[model samples]
Target: MIKKVLSFAVIGVSTVTLAIGLSPNTASAALGDQPEVFHSSYNPGKSTVTISTSNTEKKPVKASGYLSKYFKGYAHKAKNGKWQFHLDGYGDAEGLYNNVRNDQTVRVYLSEGKEQGAFDVKVKTIVKKNKVKKKKAIKISKAINGKNVKIKNNKRKSDVITIKKVSKNDKITIYNAKGKRLVQKTAKGNTIKIYVRQLGKKAGAVNVSTQKKGYKESGKIKVKYGRE
Candidate 1:
């Protein structure tokens, strides 16, 4: 059987980050006194909608803007070829944008697909917030006291040994050379124990892995049978 010992540290963080820009001031706006005609705003950052020309069918329009400072990261994408919107700081599925919108303006250019006359324009902006959580400072350790295993065959019975460490809430896994798991156990206390069949002649090397809530550690142990 294979056994392992390890230690680890746990750390975590909490925060919020939103990618959708749905706010009140960032709402969509129109350049004219039209109702059904308008533009779209970017994601969670500064929501702004600008409309130019109240053509019943505005041939589709696009708008782009930056995200808030509190946001960890932000990204946006549109439907099909409807409207081609490009924000400075916003990134596309292909890659990051060429420019960044850090105090930059929400530059939105529009053009008609069919109509060719004067068009009314409208613009609006909205703002929102988000939260996020993360884990940090996770560590793992595995140290074998000896390079050999001890075995005692009283009547060819199984040898129950307890492998422990100074870590709590740790996960332990044991595997053989062929990647076959013999016994997998979790650490409730700082240490854990296991029982392996003591074959007087079946003694060799095995891999052991231990992991905590946020940290991961691994080590190896040599099992020796027929020891007084």
Candidate 2:
């Protein structure tokens, strides 16, 4: 019997090597094993590349056909200064992983307002000519009684703050007694000139800003005397 056919071919090769060493896929990786295929490349501004693995079961990684979700078409320089973005073509690369994988990191998103910096692509510079200089028109006056206060510029011109109240309607305002309202004019017709600088503030503790511009009608007067 040829030793029973060599003992049944050595027990069928040791039961197929003990069923491939107790197979689970050859078991060994565990702690968050993630990997099926992962690749990357970015220059839209400079750096970011990822791929994970710890082998705890759960795999799905296929994005290595050439990895081009666009950026080979080139045109980067964005971060809210002027604007320019063009990654022309390329697809597939956006998220989804199961069983809490171990090392999977490849995320780059910047092109809508632009912001995600470590580097991927950002080259900027273009402003040929823009000097900027035009704001000269300032003339201030105060002569209710006169004490020499009439700063003039004519180029920075825009003034009006007249308050002549003898019967009623003298409620004016441009306060700063913590009432804070740099400028607010509303004395439309009873001689409430208000246009001081732009809308109100010929003095500091101005009163009656209640015509509804900041509400400071608490009472204050001395609109500054002695000045022509």
Candidate 3:
């Protein structure tokens, strides 16, 4: 009877060893010889691409082809365990649409040990159109017409011009008679002040203009300056 019990215990040990050998961990160790696997996703209307590795290791990857060609920086893994790449530019939506079509492929390169592997990821559908904010037209205050303004020869002093109907995004520019930019500032409120000074002893005319996106440029306004 003791011999029979010993035989059963030996068989149980052997069965457990066999099961451990067939576990997923053992199979994944052999993945170094297998092909690299990756999954890719993209955000609509944004220039972000996320790539995840099937294997949980933090391996570096290089992205190429399609919109990836215009990426400004190298791809890096984020805290969320996914690799992120960005397509950088002011007109991201238009540029992305022109560079990549529907169902395009992006090449991803990876290094496994001393060997290198590559795979292609199909691009996801992205919204081609991005909403753009319309710019507001800049309006000048009638209080300060571009005519017969007083100026001081003192470089330390400046003449302040009040502007009206200003947007936060509007930029105010002051130009001399020679078309040289003297001062440029962004508007912070409905009114902004433009300071003008005489760089030389002689009095001259200064032009003021307002600039913003999507809005017609405020034409140059001529203001006469004389020694105070």
State the lDDT of candidate 1 residue by residue for 1-228, as single tens digits.
222233444457444333454443333332222333233343212334333222112232344232221111222333762322333322221233322233334433222222222222224322223346677666656544443223344346665545645366666666565667777777777556656565234444445666657555656555434442
lDDT of 3 by residue, 26-142 (tens): 566655545333323332112334333321223422233332433322233479964544322222222331123335555443333232344344543333243698987665432
Kindly give the stretch of ten consecutive residues in candidate 1 with the minimal lDDT sum.
66-75
| Deviating ranges (above 4 Å) for candidate 3 | 1-155
Say which candidate scores most in lDDT. 3
Structural similarity to truth (TM-score) of each candidate: 0.35, 0.17, 0.31
Give all candidates' CA lDDT scores: 0.41, 0.33, 0.49
Count of residue pairs whose backbone atoms collide, per candidate: 24, 34, 0
Candidate 2 residue-wise lDDT, 1-228, digit = tens: 111111223644552222223334334232123424322333333432222221111321222323333322222224766423222223432242221112323344422122322223222222234558878654322223212122221225555455553113333455444555646544455344555453223333333333323332443333332222
How high a TM-score does candidate 2 get? 0.17
| Candidate 2 ranges with C-alpha deviation above 4 Å | 1-20, 25-34, 40-168, 171-228
